[model samples]
Target: MQFVCPQCHISYPATSQRLRCAECGGPLDVADRKRFDPAAINTEDHSLWRYRAMLSLPDGARVVSMGEGMTPLVEAGFAGQPIHFKLEYISPSGSFKDRGTTVLTTALKAWGVTRAADDSSGNAGASFAAYCARAGLAAEVFTPASASPAKLAQIAVFGARLNKVEGAREKATEALEAAAGGGLVYASHAWSPLTLEGTKTIAYEIWEQLGRGVPTCYVCPIGQGSLLLGAYRGFKDLLAAGLIAKLPRIIGVQSIACMPIVEALRQGLDRAAPVEKKLSVAEGISLARPIRDREILRAIRESGGDALAVSDDETLAAQRDLAQIGLYVEPTSAVVGAALKRLKVDGVTVAALTGSGLKSPPALR
Candidate 1:
């Protein structure tokens, strides 16, 4: 498989070690979907690796996994309509980001990477740290100072070198990028196609759980949009394989405090302009400028999806409601819960509960 720029249509080999497009500086995506083999899926494995045939890792590569995937698909209700929920927070790292971290770290192991760096508000860093620890590689995770204490604690507990950036969330990313200059492979969940390789398995699992059928809508919260893009890519592969008749409409939910993607979609722009981000309880989805903004917007538009933003109050209320149902999720994950109320759902809908509520503030819990 090769990485291709969606905008420039330029291609590069998978082993090129380049993060972005060398020509146009755009985000790179894995366009070679010929490897996806639904018939060859490893049915015995209950984790994301069950779909290993579709990943970009080299043959016989060591997979760094913690059984992350195969989350439960349970029936639930939202706004007086029945819907399905992907309980992704039950992952090893307590968040859906583990799905991507496993694949990315496995690829790193294949490439003989000794050290890696990444930036996250919380969950991605913790997931990366845990996988890198399992892979016996050194990890340096940069996180914002305002990151949840639970997530920061998880990162440190995984024995990663934690660098806390004092300013905005973007500062952590900047710090990680600068550290990557020191020969550390940037195993970024947001920027790496390898990460998407893991996350896309969620779609495959959802397809199987639905009896190889496509849902009417797929909803989730967006920060850097890794999961959203992964879902889009996976469903695209399923459609190509004739396993599904159509793709689900991708609905992205963002906090009103940081709605760059929503604003970009609303304005019909190819890329998201920077927004003055406000402090939000749903800190996980408070990214100001997503690196994959164009790709994210394209996926939503292509799938006939729309983006929406909700207030902190709405997200908090969603969290409380979910807790009452015994499904404790972080406020960021609750963004999807809030969104389900506003969307006009005509058929089966599925929303991803991205992170566990244990990652939230103690007071909120």
Candidate 2:
């Protein structure tokens, strides 16, 4: 397997720590074109590792896992419509990020990396910190100073050095990049292809749980678009294996406060457009510039998907509605619920509840 840039087709060794292509500065993807096979799945392992045959890792690498994956696909009611909510929050790190962190950490250990750095608004940082601790690697996380106290506490408790950078979310990423220059492995969820390798397992689980069929539509909150892109790739794998006829319509939700993807889609742009960043209750998806902007747009367009933005008030209302249904998720996850109300999508649809409400401020919860 090699790290290949989708934009410029530049290839790097699979074990290379470089996050993006030097030629084009685009995010890299694993160039392993291995197809998915249901018979090859390790039925005994319930975690994402069950799809070990499909993952792109060094041969014989030890999987650093905390039993993350196979989140319950619960069919619930939202706005008088029955929808399947993929509860990704019931994870080792209280968010969907554990899926990527597990695989990324395993890859880092395989590559002989002992120290790693990453940045996130909250969930991804906490998740990476926890996984690094499990792998006995020195971990440092850079997060926005305005990040939730609960999430910062989680990162600190895992024994990882936490750097709270003041200002915008991108400032935290800048801090992480500076540390990476000082010899720390950049285990970024947005830039690392291995992270997608882990997140694609979600599509496999959804297929397995849904009687080996694809859903009509899949909705999820998008920041860096890892979850959506990963699911799209997984479904593509299933399609290659002849297990499914077509990919599901993937709907990406963003906050109206910071909706670059939505604006780009509306304008038929090939990349995410620069927009005025505003403070949002859903801090997690408030990314002003996603690294994989072009790839995300392609995924949405190719799958006949759409991107939509919801207001903060609508997101909070959705949060309350989800809580009423016993699904307590962070405001970021609630964006999907708000999008669903707007789409009023019928038939078999899955909404990814990405993070736990416990990770948010107590007042929000």
Find the candidate with the highest lDDT and give its number.
2
Clashing pairs in 2: none
- Residues 1-365 of candidate 2 have per-residue lDDT tens digits of 58888778878988747788899877888886568989999999989899988788876689999999999999988898999999999999999999999999998888889888899898999999999999999999999999999999999999999999999898888877777856688888888888889899999999999999989999999998889988998999999898999999989999999999999999999988778899998899998878888888998999999999999999999999999999999999999999988987867999999999998844844
Candidate that would win on TM-score: 2
**Candidate 2 overall Cα lDDT vs. reference?**
0.90
lDDT value for model 1: 0.87
TM-score of each: 0.96, 0.97
Q: Clash totals for all models, in order?
A: 0, 0
Badly placed stretches (over 4 Å) of model 1 are 362-365
Tens-digit per-residue lDDT, 172-245, candidate 1: 98887777755688877787878778888888999999998879999999998989988998899888887787
Q: Please give the TM-score that candidate 1 achieves against the real structure.
A: 0.96
